[model samples]
Target: MVAPALILVILVTLWPVAQSFYNSLFDYRLTDPSRSERFTQSNIDLERYATEYFYISRDLEDLSAQAPDDETAQAVNDIQTEIEAFHSELIEMDGLEEQYGEVDEMIASFTAISDRDLKYAEVDNDWAEGYKDFLAASNEELIALSEGAPEEDFSTTAGNVAGTLDTINSAVIESNFIGLSNYSRYLQDARMWQSLLNTFIFTIASVAVELVLGLAIAILINRVFIGRGVVRASVLIPWAIPTAVAAMMWGFLYDGQTGIVAHYFEQFGLINDASVLLSTANGGMFSVIFADVWKTTPYMALLLLAGLQTIPGSLYEAAEVDGAGKWQQFWKVTLPLLKSAILVALLFRTLDAFRVFDLIYVLTGGGPANSTESISIYAYITLFSQQNFGAGSVLSVIVFLCVALISTLFIKFIGSDLFEGRSR
Candidate 1:
């Protein structure tokens, strides 16, 4: 029974992370044609190679016949022979001849080779290197010949052939596997470090404020009152709002001009100007933290309220009978019993706060110069906006590590308390 559930957990949780880790090992980017997929060895894009080779072969044959001198004609013929020799070797590779023939036929018929296996073929690393070097040298020679050729048409044709050779060289895709270089690159990236610092600041500040306010609110609601149910329900309204919706609503409230909340803040002297809220780095950070605290404090209060109810009323009564005042009773009885609940609440909130994305994304958009950019937001931009999967995955793995570390520390504290209780 446990095995089945554990297997499910691994499949659902670990599989995606493993896939991301694998992607991080390559220089994967969707925007670049050559690096759109993960390749561990050099390969030829048969579709592009076959099409360009057909035209290049014909052009080279024409150039040799039209050469201005015997030396030029011989150079053209030799370049064509070397290219054909490399091509012959390429098509002879295992399982490539059939695909190459198909691609050639497709090109002749003006049909696209849509199958990936028919469009790309693995080639030996040494062969690819030699082919690329030969093409580069041949292109330079053709360019030099074109510049010195007397006939204008011959000069133009030679330059065009040289351009074709360069294109063919690019068809030889090298391995994109960079191993751990993406991780190392980002380790020195200043933006990555700054974004991480912003994330930590937001998490620590928001969680700390929420904990204090939440505890006070929970204590207030726990006492008997005529409208306690209404009060408790009303307190949850902010948390009940969808985070994106809340963030958008706060966006309006924080607007520099024509915003009621901003006006009130200015009147309260919290800021020198209403526009400063959305236009300055420090102000942007404060705005996000404040909005987060308002939206999440009720959640924190609810969790603590549950823990507060678990404490027997007799304990408080006993403390009072011993002449302990309210503060003394709270410190002696309420706090000690509430340790586990507080830790649990802190764990949940800290993890959630550290991974914050939508709230800050919609609120400040990590702006006023990215003063409030969290690591998650940075990853989202790199992964989606920039289409850089390798670097984005590194950021994602970093977030997972940070969250794991925080959870480990909190669990250790909770576990030690449990062990001590059991021993007692």
Candidate 2:
């Protein structure tokens, strides 16, 4: 019985974690042409760029026909020079494809690191240097393309040259990972620290605001009052609205030119102007956090309200009989009994808030100087925008660990009885 339970835990929880670790050991691309013969076949963007370059070249030719002076001639020449460089780069990229196609030497470098047979420098620099030489060959070809460079010829060639570019990208990643370098890099990395600090500040303030406001709303809704049913629904309106939709709603309201938030803050002298609110570092963070709190406060309230309802009325009545006033009864009887429920709610909401991405993503896009960048948004920018896979993987691990640590600590405070029914 224990064997089956242990196996289940390993499969469900441990395996994927182990796989992330496994992958972290190797520097590889998910879609490296070195791994596939179908790069040109699958890449729609390659063909699209090729077409775009063709059109751009033609547009330049047409513009050149209308040049009125030496200055105009020089400007056209500058633009064409850049375009021609692109053309040459594409042609040379084909040889890069052929070179790294199942590059055993580079693979040996990565494999040696995986097996602990090579030092950091050997795997990172030496192998990367090997890749760079091939890439240089690709760059040289790009240098050779003339004004008569054929666009059709490049569709096939870009896929080839792209292989070397891919290798260079991989090398940049391996350099980030191999030693205590990333830690040093992380320390020196202003953007990373700023984002990390902002995330912490947002997490703390948002969690605090949600809990205080949520408890007040939950207590109010729990009582017998007029329009109780209608009031409950009204209170939940914010929660019922999807986060993305709410974020967008707030985005419009906070829009620089025609936004209500910007207008109000400006009218009341709370902000200097609409652009200032969204563009200033402190104001941007404040706006993002406020928007998140507005959208999600009701969610926290609903959780607390559920816990409040489960507290038996009898306890409060007994407290009243014992000469406890409403406040005292709330403090001694209701609060004590509802501690478990509150803990459960807080645990869920805190974890969710720590991973906040969408609201910040929509409302601010981690900008006006990245003051509102949550870890989730940071991970996204790394993975998708920067396309730095190694750093992104490291960030994913960090996010998971932070959330897990928070949950563990919170659960410990509430005690194991809360989870007694659930087995590992």
Q: Using lDDT as the measure, which candidate wins?
A: 1
Which residue pairs collide in model 2, if any? 88-142, 89-142, 93-160, 93-161, 94-160, 94-161
TM-score of 1: 0.94
lDDT of 2 at 368: 76
Candidate 1 on 293-369: residue-level lDDT in tens?
A: 99999999999999999999999889889999999998999999999999989988999999999999999999978
C-alpha lDDT of all candidate models, in order:
0.92, 0.64
Candidate 2 — which residues are off by over 4 angstroms? 1-16, 26-180, 421-424
Model 2: per-residue lDDT, tens digit, 228-282?
A: 7786687678888888888889888888898988898889998877777678888
Global lDDT of model 1: 0.92
In model 2, state the lDDT of residue 157: 38
